[model samples]
Target: MKDIVEQNYSSSQYIVLIFCRLLIGWHLLYEGVVKLMNPNWSAKLYLMDSSGPFKSFFFWLAQDKIILPVVDLLNQWGLVFIGIGLMIGLFARLSAILGATILGLYYLSHPAIIGADYLLPNEGSYLLVNKNLIELASLLVIYLFPTSYKIGIDRLIFKKHE
Candidate 1:
């Protein structure tokens, strides 16, 4: 029997996935560009304000003068590259994984876990998980479903045997 997801999907499903990918990609791209445009911009504040379990590690990264710049550079470039990859449907799975990793870090930094209070301003209220977790979950969906075959470079590079 064919797998459930392997069954034919309506055009809407494909379009929705494409739109989701585009939306997330656009967000990542915009953020990266903004940071790149401003040399003084750094992830230091976010790192320093991190709460929950990884608080110490994140604080270390934020305060460590030597490592702070390196972290900042990687964070910016990772967002740019991952954004481009997702927008162009190039190495989408890899992009999704990378994006998830970035989001996971962000989520951990300002964890919305129940009963926890944070000094940082939040985009929205959440419990246990926030938009970051939601987006991360979306990336995981994209990774598993792989609509890249329908509208991505993966279609050409990873041709499936009939």
Candidate 2:
């Protein structure tokens, strides 16, 4: 079966998809930049505060001095790269998948299940659904619809090959 859906989407559909992509990209980029700018910023607290079934693994990742640095670097850079790719519609599908994966990891580590609490306060209350999951779903939709090649940098990049 084909992975990406191919269709002649209406202008409105394209507009909505592009809007979503840009918004998500901006959010990711902002997060990455904030982390990058702060020398003291680290995922240690967040990982240590994890409360899901994978709590042990996340805690291990946070406590490991060697691995922690690598993890912090990858997380920050990954967000930046993914955000840029999505914003410019360059390798958008890959960006969407990567974004979803990162968000998935976040959601798994801090699930919004009942009675679960964390050191980091949530902006809103949730129960089994939250912004991370919503954003992850949005990325999945972006991946499935894939409008970058039609209206993004991908258009120029892939047009030469086509």
Residue-level lDDT of model 2, residues 43-155, one tens digit each, is 99999999978999999999998999998998999999999989999999999999999999999889998888887755899989999999999999999899888878987
Best-fitting candidate, scored by lDDT? 2
Computed on alpha carbons, the lDDT of every model, listed in order, comes to: 0.84, 0.90
**lDDT value, candidate 2, whole model:** 0.90
Q: How good is model 2 by TM-score?
A: 0.94
- Residue 115 lDDT in model 1? 66
Candidate 1 per-residue lDDT over residues 40-125, each given as its tens digit? 89999888778888889999999999999999999999999889888888888799889999998888888897766777754678
- Stretches of candidate 2 exceeding 4 Å from the true structure: 1-6, 160-162
**Global fold similarity of model 1 (TM-score):** 0.88
Listed per model in order, the count of residue pairs whose N, CA or C atoms clash below 3 Å is 0, 0
Extract clashing residue pairs from model 2: none
The candidate 1 region of ten consecutive residues with least summed lDDT is: 1-10
